[model samples]
Target: MKTNYLALLSLISILPLYAQQVKFEDFFTDQTMRIDYHHIGDAKSELVTIDQIYGYGIWAGSLLHLIDNFNNGAYYYKIYDEATGALIFSKGFDSYFKEYQTSDAAINGIKKAYHESAIIPYPKNKIRFALEKRGKQNELNEIFNVLIDPADLYIIKEEAKDKDVTVIKALYNGDPHTKLDVVILGDGYTSSEKAKFEKDLKRFTDLFVSSEPYKSNKNDINIYGVFKPSEESGTDEPGAGIYKNTVLNTTFYSLGSERYLLTEDNKTMRNLAAFVPYDAIYIMVNSPRYGGGGIYNFYCTFVSDNQFSDYIFLHEFGHSFAGLADEYYTSDVAYNEFYPAGLEPVEPNITRLLDKNNLKWKNLIAPGIEIPTQWEKKDYDANDYIWLKERTAMNKNIANLKRNKAPKEQIDAAQIEYNNKDKAHSDAVDKYLKSSKYWDMVGAFEGAGYSAEGLYRPMLDCLMFSKGTKPLCKVCADHAAKIIKHYTE
Candidate 1:
């Protein structure tokens, strides 16, 4: 009886090891399968429908890590072997449709549609694909599922688009399968601006590799740039009544936020990106506007010429790559209840602090420090409130001036005045925050994720929380390092 019991325990220990030993060639091919679909719905209801499937470039994702263990993103997808019904692959990603659902238009029962694509390793046989979304209580519920056959006649297998597009190998470490691959695309650069695009790509790549956790793991990354010129020189500024014939159709004023820049042309972007192997996408606009946007595992965008361009690049990538939540609650955003009350956010940087003993980043908390570590919130908020109001009024005034076709000198002077004041305020705030007793500590700092209360950040100041060249907080850095390992190791 003792021998039998010991054997049963031994069997249990080996089960998980066997499950983790899923081979890549067992159920997948060497190519890529992209499932395109239309995500339709409003705030109350959502639906997804198949559009077209494409067979494209060689698979670039990690062959070892087929399953995503990170519980991130608003939506999740799973691929299963049809014959055995065993889960083979899965990933979590945020989509533009998910963000749009939180917009006022969706809240008012206005339905919209967004084209999205799911890229996976080509299957060796028939497979079942399923997509799940997070409910109000943070549980994933399956919303869409379909059976896909590898040999389907309707699958589009064609030549790669934009063969003539310039490809710049900004940084190459090794095989893409063994490294985290990042593809950078340019928009709104005219054909004559090819040199400028290359220069901009090099600058961004250097900055990316110089920043820590990426800086520490630079050898595990590969960066590529896909440059396709547009007929115009800059992206659209709808609030200022300016439009351009850009390649990606990127624009500012996304979801009514003046500085939020994003592109809805997912298909075109994907087509261009097919030229290379990538795990993440970044769009670099040719404009000088102070605008950019990022969605977890979806994409990130930033303008090329701006005083805060470097900060935006690093900050937005934190969201797109590491799933870090915004740590600032003072700024206005189009999202309504982005992080719902009474629930913990999936982002690693911010939490609801429901369980003090089991904090998301409990291991990193400072020794003997309080869980809800208090900071100079009242003093900061008082100044932030005044700055926020001034910023809104300044943006409105500039937009109106542009609409009225004000002289270039007049517009430039107004912008200069505002920029000067903005710099002063930012400098003062940074100095004040650095003087805090908890500035160098790792503890739950209140006021994060668009909530002035409840949601707590991992630090007092980080790239996610402010407009500076600050490194990611310790919690965010650890999460990012894990993601890097997921791709490379």
Candidate 2:
């Protein structure tokens, strides 16, 4: 006890040095530097070039924890003081560009560009910005580097919006730095629909903070909304050939996956998001299309009026906030071989079980739980694979009918048959999943991260595993807690 007290005193003495007076404020202002760039790539090659730099509004992230400890996202970037050669701000992130490169068109050497942006604290001196991306085997390779001068005349001095937009304080605590700052933006809502955006944003955020880790850590969060109205409502539907005059040209059928909704309008989206100091961005498109997208440390999207909006929001937030992966493997995603085999995924929840003794969430396993956890996986997968085949077949047919401009009657008929078949499949999956056997175990369960063969999840049933009413799995929930601490602690 005496020795323990002495160690505590030693830690207390060194704490002041770690929190030195010449800390974050000495090198950075409270404002944000929004660096916009063009990410050009094909499956064979990829690179980044600076497009624009702006002095955005206040910086809302943690001043003390300048370095991100959570290893997430397909890409990672860092900011270093050129004068002192000190790492200042760093983040792991993903983008639509990275996702696009995995498409079949990209493998055919169809090169393209995606507008991307990152927000950091406004530096007082020259800084070196570097970005590294995770390659095929999860190896980090430096892809882009730039020298930034805060006083450079080329750095544009602009606010978040060109035209006026209402900034609603949906949920605000005292200061942003101590809280996880989230800014919600709406696409495809008209000026008159601003009220609806606010209401919907409020509804989802309330639902968001009320979920597992967020529910227990509510006061540690701040929610803001940027209400940008479009001339017309509803986003684009390329499969159905419907386009609208929305600022952020959000679209469904991204990468030919009908439900994988995302936007290539990164500049416009980031522009509106910077209206408020935000740590995370959520874009709610005004459509009932049952679609959304989420990238780690980037942003998450959801359809505003979908019947499954609540569930979708939670699932996507798990990706965007806690960097959790989709444990469900049965869905047909555009990502072909998304998580490469043999390499352990960095997501907190899912694992390849390369080292059964050192599973990612090994500490969270309940006592006596089997390592390669036993569940009704053989029975579950047998039924799940069948359901996936039917679902994919139905979706492919619908997409084809839409692309060919089939008559409304034919389309309706196709959808009716698909719906009835879907109901039957859903019931079978539920029964297969409802067995009480090993449901509460924390051992690794096979089939996760879009793979049925090698990948495994930490639990049998979870929000990450399914759209069922279960909370996030133990591993996922613990990650959420760690993320909240990253911002608030």
Candidate 3:
């Protein structure tokens, strides 16, 4: 075969720093190689060991844009064309393993291992796969690197498991390779609840597509429902004294945070997801409780029947899909200062404002807008603290009641009071913030990335900032649009 290194180099010369420099066909096959591994760590250390490598259906990601230039994850993995020393494919991602290290257990010196996986377009020849993680300074540091040979006899060639899996196309507009492929899996729905799962999938997808970037990019997206019915009908709620034999092993009270729902069974989740082509995973648990979680490029989980399912589904997807950081800081979270002080965050929405000389999104900043813009932060923070404090106490009481086997009436009453208090405080802030003067201003607003004092967001009220009645801020929309294009463009 002939080569065109000069032309290819010239083609990518004007491209972004992380853009793929090699032809997709020159190095990759149509299939995907899923590298499953165990990521083990404590507060101060981490390690990853290969579990198995399997052929996961077709490659659903962009064939034209093989390299990821987005750079929006706590951890990143890149595949190199060893013969030519050129980058072929890469992706930025966050994992439950990394998030787990921030928990009280790990911080207190408890060690644990998490099951995880990363998939890439299958390569034709030997290639080098390097896994890199961000440090406290938020710099990309290579932690693990290995050479993968396609002809190795040890490479597993198993078919997609769960052949009985019933998949329905929820949103199909284009080819998998040319469009964003999203797979929605049901965690605790049983055979009897398959219809409900389908219905919820439609509802979830409808709301998701109605959002900013997704609303405009509907034609370039494909959504599917992969139903692996559980024996029971709801996820395990450890704090609520309820447990179920769910298919994906999802549970609430992750890291002692009541609402941080997650699943530790990555192997099973990936196996179920293997039933279809997927660029991202959205696991909807069959429950009415208010809880969910998202890990970048890994998966996002939401409780399907909750009152706030729609909002949470989209919010968590922002984290898992586009790597949007949480702009709200009042609520309790597992991590301590997840965003570092000096370095810039990889997410598009939040900024540390350390480099006033070079704003990350200075081009989008409207003229005359202050860099560290002002808002009703004192008022916003005041109401937010009241709401969060009450909510925390409410959750704590409910958990205790459940543990004591208190009457169902008592539990319902506690939730009702909390809900009423939540509604009143939310209404007060929303009314004040929604006033014409403060809305839609795109600048650096103090209080974001889990810190009310240090971090600055691009807008006053955003999907990341608060659950207010506003679409994504302009900054968020731009970042999300780029992510959508990364898959479909």
Candidate with best TM-score: 1
lDDT for each candidate structure: 0.90, 0.82, 0.83
Name the candidate that leads on lDDT: 1
Model 1 misplaced stretches (Cα beyond 4 Å): 1-19
Cα distance off (Å), candidate 3, residue 271: 0.5
Q: Model 3, 1-489: lDDT tens per residue?
A: 124543543454466554544678888889989988889989898988888888746788888888777878888887766666467788889988788888888998899999988799999998777788987777778798777888788888887766558989999997898899999999899999888998999998898888888999989999999998799989888987889998999999888788999999998998888888899999999987788998888999999876567778888888888888898888889996587677788888888898876887787887798778878788777877877887888888988887899999998898778767766776776688778364776778888888888788887777776663457778888988998998897
- Worst window of 10 by summed lDDT in candidate 3: 1-10
Query: Which wins on lDDT, candidate 2 or candidate 3?
Result: 3
Measured with C-alpha atoms, the lDDT of residue 234 in candidate 1 is 95
TM-score of 2: 0.90
Q: Would you list the clashing residue pairs of candidate 2?
A: none
Q: Give the TM-score of candidate 1.
A: 0.96
Runs in model 2 deviating more than 4 A are 1-22, 135-137, 161-164, 396-431
**For model 3, which pairs clash?**
none
Model 1 residue 159 CA deviation in Å: 3.4
Quick one: how many clashes does candidate 1 have?
0
Each model's TM-score? Answer: 0.96, 0.90, 0.94
lDDT of 1 by residue, 382-436 (tens): 9999999999999888988998999999999989988888878888888999999
